[model samples]
Target: MFDQSRGFRDDAVETCPVEYVVRKDGKPFAFLNATPALATRTVTGFALATPEADWTFERI
Candidate 1:
């Protein structure tokens, strides 16, 4: 009898860049840093809802 066999295949991929946050109202928004550009800035606070605090979170 004759032997008939198929060849094996290896498939793999690495991403050059990845997208994380989606845009909101044509503007980009993210709760956490994802991409290199997003991870560049230094963030240390969140939006607070208080009468005393001058700065608060608002949708642009």
Candidate 2:
């Protein structure tokens, strides 16, 4: 699901634990944590977007 055209980049750390880090065009984007949290924004640009649905939790 990693699309090069979208200019998405991902990384992870070992010593300090974190799920993963995501970036776009070499800038800070998102941090996918180990636990789920409320979705504060609506998904638009990604495929299978559920704009109509009241998405409450994030799990990736």
Whole-model lDDT per candidate:
0.32, 0.36
Model 2 TM: 0.26
Q: TM-scores across all candidates?
A: 0.20, 0.26
Per-residue lDDT, model 2, residue 40, is 30
Candidate 1 lDDT tens digits, 34-56: 43443333121322223333331
- Native-to-model Cα distance after best TM-score fit, residue 47 in candidate 1, in Å: 21
Best by the lDDT measure? 2
Residue-pair clashes per prediction, in order, are: 0, 0
Candidate 2 lDDT, tens digit per residue, 1-60? 345876553432222233444434344456655422212322222213534433232334
Q: Give model 1's TM-score versus the native structure.
A: 0.20
Clash pairs detected, candidate 1? none
